[model samples]
Target: MGTPELALQVEPARWLGAPAPGGLALPPARAGRGTLYAPRGVYLDDRVVVVADSGNHRVLLWYGWPKADHQPADVVLGHTEFEAEGPGLLHLPTAVALVEGRLLVADAWHHRILVWDDLPEGSGQPPDRVIGQPDLRSTVPNAGGSPGPAGFYWPYGFTYVHGWFYVADTGNRRVLGWRGVPEGLRPADLVLGQPDAYSGAENRGRGVGADTFRWPHALVGDEMTLYVADAGNHRVLGFTPPPEQDRPADLVLGQEDFDRDFELPHVPQGPQRLRFPYGVALCRDYLAVADTANNRVLLFPGPPRRGVYLPAAHVIGQANFAESGENRWRAVGWDTLCWPYGVWGYQDLLAVADSGNNRVMIWRLRRS
Candidate 1:
């Protein structure tokens, strides 16, 4: 099969978190005018666009589609200023999700998830609740250095769908789910990567298998399917109908089979391989993945409708799959990417968290 021909390009020259925006400019010594540093999380809906400004230890919220580059965000979370980084503030927050009038943040380094009921109107407001730890001041994994249903270590990303809440507990090599939005450190009703909720071992402290995960970093889905970017395992796992309890995934991408976790050692680079796929997004008939270490994003014309190996129909950042260099070994531009880690697609718009570039690139799919 020929390389899939789904063409995409940057939508606007105005990039979010850029320095031109007011109030959060980085110091002169820094590389860019914007304050973002290694940002890894992004969420977009009809009302707003939210980004986990990881390096700044803050989150930026834009109330609507930005009409120009360097537009200022409407709200800031975790700190009053962008340059400040401290405890009791977000530490490498990697994901953001808003549901049911509440804002959710995966404060990864703090080993907790923070909740804000009714989005804050400005900066420096504290969250209404904290999950994974007993309180906002405690950063201990599992709240005291042991694994249980309520604790988390480096929770990287999350999603809320159909009244259920999910988190990619990266450091623990698992995924946790709640029947609804969690109010506190309530025990997860569902767990993946181990036999039960209490186990936090890598790959369940066993060899690689179809049922285990090394680093499950992101979650995205609709009403019928849930996709996980299993970063450490270099693959994407798909669960049809979205598992309500611990169960084996029905579909796998980036490898020939569930047991094969190694990257392809040969000539061509194509859909059959993935190197640290850190994010996934599914739209009507499209699937996009942030192939992070590979410095590219892979796009499929349609999600796997069955359990089969389907090659990527298109690619972004690099001319083709065989090339995997940051900015394709050239100066960074709107068309290029470096270590891109998050993807959000809604309707015709697709947003990419271009981490190494310190900017979010929005693209629109070209109609055939």
Candidate 2:
């Protein structure tokens, strides 16, 4: 596939959290509707926008796409109010998604997934169901026991596609999938990166391979293809026809091969290499990766063919493909990024969870 004829604006069209003005200093953590602190995940569409304000241990929601910078969120989750911040329910929510009108949150620190039957209209709305734990109040790694199909340990990201729900069970170093929004305490139908549900070793307790992950942080795809950001391995792995069970990936990105997982010394990196890539999203035919440690986002023309190393068509949050620095090794700017952790592409808009900068940016595709 070729790179699509698409371009993203150098600056975001709209943003939430941090003030728009650029600077070199890091912003302080604040709790309120218009502020964010080390946000780790984001979801966007024409109807709604969700941000995982991880530092605040809460999730913020805009009933609709915001029209201004630092717009206040319409609803708050994981807490009773925006200012009350003493670990109410969520320990550190890292991701959010909507499936069939239901809201799903990856309450990462608590090691569970929270599901709300419908979007809540107010703050502190408890989830209708919970996953990874036997009940809502029980929060433990692998349910305080060995790893299993139904347990999670720091499950940081997830997605719903083709009626199936997939989760990046990070601490377990694997991915778990269910046929649909599961009820309660039901085991996943499929597992990836491990020999069985009971295994949770990094790279299967050995070296890296096409079928193992060091840190499976985020994922996106459909029934045709799936992409996972293996952050700890510094690469993204692609699975064709969506793996039905543990299997080797059909493609690898950010490195020359699946066995290599080294992070090059801080310098200008080639388009084909990635350093701690943490997020992946598909926009039309293009793939957007949050090259986290590189402090930028890489956009591939489209899904590359089965190959070891593939180059990206464009780069965002930096001056060029060769530059890899947090805010370009200087002050923060509208076009710069600092350790972006999540990305979402819909139509022509790209939502980025700029984690290090404590903000979420919404960039638009530049029309020719």
Task: Name the top lDDT candidate.
Answer: 2
- Tell me the whole-model lDDT of each prediction, alpha carbons only: 0.78, 0.87
Clashes of 2: 2
Top of the candidates by TM-score: 2
In model 1, which residue pairs have backbone atoms overlapping below 3 Å? Answer: 4-313, 14-69, 19-33, 19-34
Off by more than 4 A, model 1: 1-14, 19-33, 86-88, 264-268
What lDDT tens digits, residue by residue, belong to model 1 across residues 1-368?
Answer: 12435444424334665532222232121313245677798888788888887777788888878777666667778877655655448888888878788899899998899999887787778888888888777887878867789899899988886777888998889999998877657889889778987788878888666678999999988777888899888889888888788877877888778876777533456766888899998754778889898888888666774474568777878877788887777666667788899888878777888888777877776554
Instruction: Return the lDDT, model 2, position 303.
Output: 62
Error in Å for residue 155 of model 1: 0.7
- All predictions: root-mean-square deviation over Cα? 3.8, 2.1
RMSD value for candidate 2: 2.1
Model 1 vs. true fold: TM? 0.90
